[model samples]
Target: MSNNDIKFIHWFRSASPYIRVHKGKTFVIHMDDSVIGSDNFTGLVHDLALLNSLEIRLVLVFSTRHSIESRLNDHADVSHYHNGIRITDSETMEVIKDAAGKLRVEIEAALSVGLGNTPMLNAKVIISSGNYVRAKPMGVVDGVDYLYTGTVRSIETETINKQLDANEIVLIPPLGYSITGDVFNLQATALTRDVATKLGADKIIYLSSVDGISDQSGKLIKEMIVTEAEKYLLENKIPDAAEQQLLSHAVYACKKGIDRVHVINSSLDGGLIQELFSRDGVGTMISSTSFDELRQATVDDISGILELIVPLEKSGVLVERSREKLELEIENFTVMLRDDVIIGCGALYLYEKEMTAEVACLVIHGDYKNSGRGEQIYSVLEQRARENSIDSIFVLTTQAEHWFRELGFDEISVDELPVEKKELYNFKRNSKIFIKKLN
Candidate 1:
């Protein structure tokens, strides 16, 4: 894989539950201009690169509104409120064109670079607005006609899908035209959500200028299920305006069967990769209640297993074990597999005592790292320990101290080990002792 592909895989492993759930399926990426400045944008690019490398079918959609230059020239007095509401008058409609037009060109330019200069510029970028969106005017809600602003009446899903199938990235400007040929300015957020819902996208990621959804304490809310996000919104737990938008998008995505949605900062370097590839990501992920399982390793699983471990072993992040050793001990191992391939694996060693055992050789395949596969394997091993009447389990690892610490394993001096274990420890290469009590 290329560097961008590796970065993308890392990000996917971190933030997306669909990585495990939606194997061999197509993905549609919806990004807007605001995403251009965030660290998450780089990760988004990384994910796109990865999908390309893996030969996964992907549809990348870039949405934008008009440019500030056009808007200013058209409506000299129009301005936007802090809440993202535009203060518009009759003249505002004239300037809306400039803003939306300039923004679209800028977005296309960015995407061209993001796609690795892959000829996306010359490639067909279906840019049009007409019956593509059926909208009704947001007519005078209280005493205002709400001139030029409209809500979606319907989206032409078939047309969008046809272009998506042709691998043409759809670029939707916030300007939409009615069948009667009247031009109306639309909110980018509203348009994006409508398009995503209409298309039934697999994932909808919102890249924002802020640090993502946060609790009252200002710490980033890393992951949340749909129910938890609703409660947070209802209770006013989210602290900022940016977070509120993210929560709203997340809830909308979940309700619309988008499967998963991510709200992350766009300014941080590798922000997207951290969210997609690592377990403790830098943003919030909202999804449904889908828990994956760990299974027994099979003979056909060796290649993927090797791909995961070889790099780590070469860099000494994992112990160097021969393929023969792995094949022989394959029966002693349990793996977290998705789509008939192993994403994670670990070994269980049975000791003589009825209530004691050792869990060792834990490894998460490189591409699958940080997706909680390691934790799943550990949970399974703990259950197996109970089944075998093992009261406690221990592990020795040179690295991954923090990982084991987070899982409730406390460090113990080597002197506390059983005589045989201590002897084994002495002969073993790199080691740190971790013990977990099972009752």
Candidate 2:
């Protein structure tokens, strides 16, 4: 009915695929104590409830850092840390337990919300917590005993799985109890990574304090592989405690066989939903798989490239060219592939005399049309054109006019094209010309 409504419909339809992919998959999400106290806590709770309603099995892990600090402050004790870990003496363990117990109740209460005319309205979300984690004392190290500070010994996967199968969201706290009747303060990030690895979770997400992991310039990284994450952690001096913990544990989780680990800022309303449901999620994703592989197209890629564009050619949206012509121009093309499949491709034909390049034959597989592949291919060609001292880039298209226009291209008459290209222009095709200034 309206532009906004149409956009919403498109977004909703696009989200359905992700929803389907998430269905029945187990995800372990971790949040720090500050998340429970944030202004957007209620909204975060609603997102968790929505995920449950979507039939996604969830395991939520949380820490009581700020709350524990508050308790320690009130009890007249100064906190101590060894190698970035809190030295949890018996006295500190009391503050941890008190803070964690209160938080567990608050989290459960928040998730139990049921109201009218709201996202949580009519949403029935069941929460379950347990001693699902077994831990042992982090004994003396370097002559400094981490008394009452525990490391995860093992995770009760079967019990956690049973609760998840029963449609219950498992909320695990950072404190763990030993068989010897001792409650120990556990490092939340360590526990989250251990639990996710043990359960073989489909995904593990950390709701961070920062707006995901950012570079020195404060730009958030969209995705990275485990190796790249390791290098990043070594390179970036992240200032936020929560952000550092999320990154360190994300690298650990991905290396330990967890395929995906996401980090998003919990302060944003509905941030979790945006992180999970959207492509190029509103967070940094540390993944096991390489996101894409872009390289120059060779003769071997001819068949794959042809298959990629045959449909568009048949539909008269693309100008059909013979195999011999493609062979001659193969060196001008670049392809972005995933898992060895040529998902997208484009060609850059340079007119040296005019210092202009023609970008043509751009096509992304139907499934990947809206997945940013086309823009990626364009960027590659644009960069290549710049490297060759090209002054401008142009495209002639019977379709995708609006797509190019949206990316800062200006509609231009064909007469402005390079003289050589002008001579070859096909009036029968009547393709619209669009030009992008490179300088």
Candidate 3:
């Protein structure tokens, strides 16, 4: 496809549950050491690069509690999972250097090459170990002595912000230090949370192996709030440790005033794009409540509404309502506009003391279909009905039965129509009768 097509797709995917956009916002991505060799890494880098192209500031911190040498000595058997965190033993720690350091360099090189090729990639990307992290070693708990594990004591927020302001991506290795000059291994997820909180980032996204957040039937949960997530977690239905971490981070981000958080599967092609731009995102979105209102259609909105319904009218899916008719009833029309662009429009025709009004000409732009705009327009008409003290609303649609059904409209027989409407119905084009009760 062309560049414009790609951009349109990008915008569509931005509203998806799996894709998230922190436009003019700061974000921190915790890249677990295990993700280094995973198939998802290349796509992850590309997605991050795409974000950079959009001028959204971000930081990527790689964390590994085990050194590469340890993994090699252990014959690469040091398994890592759960919230993208790797469990490390003494043998694992010995080989972690191979994964964390050497592997980091390779990843950095790959990102550099990729960025260099893209005209949009101009941000400075810095790669460093936990050299700047002030850490405290973990203490023994229960019957297990946590080997080289350490938690973040402090992150140099000033340094991070300075880099971010300069349009740089900061990459941190999972190595931390104490005031006494002791270095320790750290969990990638823990460090990511600490740094993101410290930086007051807009979001913190975790790309995992599983398909985003799922319901009891394993279907993805599209949108949710922290309270809902907390309830889900309390019921022990979140399913896995990774999901638990995603929920924890989402709650933390919400509590800290971060706009939103997302957890998605990295393996899916274009998963990031699907999550960030599409209305029904691929993964789950934990966000604050959103309330939408409809306003009076403006003069500038006429052309857009006409364009939206023109195709349907041509195909006989909708009746051909002339622009002259629209101009006359302009005051009775309501429109849904996003960024001043009309995505949907509908009209209300009043009758004197009839206790009902006709809700006609509902149309949503093709690109914005399935975005609930039609329902929003219908809601506006219902509110108008209440204002006018009308008890019910009527519609005549040749198609769109399911759409009307979703709005609580019922299929009423032609005989149910009032005398005046029935007379008009007989003289006018063929259409199905639909009625919605306001009371």
How high is each candidate's TM-score?
A: 0.61, 0.70, 0.63
Error of 1 at 168 (Å): 2.0
Alpha carbon lDDT at 22, candidate 3 = 44
Task: After the best TM-score superposition of candidate 3, give how far the Cα of residue 47 lies from its true spot, in angstroms.
Answer: 3.3
Alpha-carbon shift of residue 259 in model 1 (angstroms): 3.0
Q: How are the candidates ranked when ordered by TM-score, highest leading?
A: 2, 3, 1
Note the Cα lDDT for every prediction shown.
Answer: 0.66, 0.86, 0.70
Q: What is the lDDT of candidate 3?
A: 0.70
* Backbone clashes in model 3: 33
lDDT for position 91 in model 3: 56
Worst 10 residues of 2 by lDDT: 236-245
Compose the digit string of candidate 1's lDDT tens values, residues 143-206: 6566667778787888877765655455666666777777776666666667777788766656
In model 1, which runs have C-alpha deviations exceeding 4 angstroms? 1-70, 73-75, 80-90, 109-131, 140-145, 267-282, 290-304, 308-334, 337-343, 346-439
Write candidate 2's Cα lDDT for 1-439 as tens digits.
9999999997996576577668899899888778895788988888898899999999999988888787788878899998889999877887788888899999999988798877788888889998888889999999999999999988899999999999999999997888998988899878888999999998988886678887667778888898888887787666556577678898888888888888888787878988787655788888876868899999988877887787789999999988899999999999887535577899999999999999999998787778788998999999999999999999999889999999889999978998888999999999999999988
Q: Which is better, 1 or 2, measured by lDDT?
A: 2
lDDT of 1 at 383: 89
The TM-score between candidate 2 and the true structure equals: 0.70
**Which wins on TM-score, candidate 2 or candidate 3?**
2
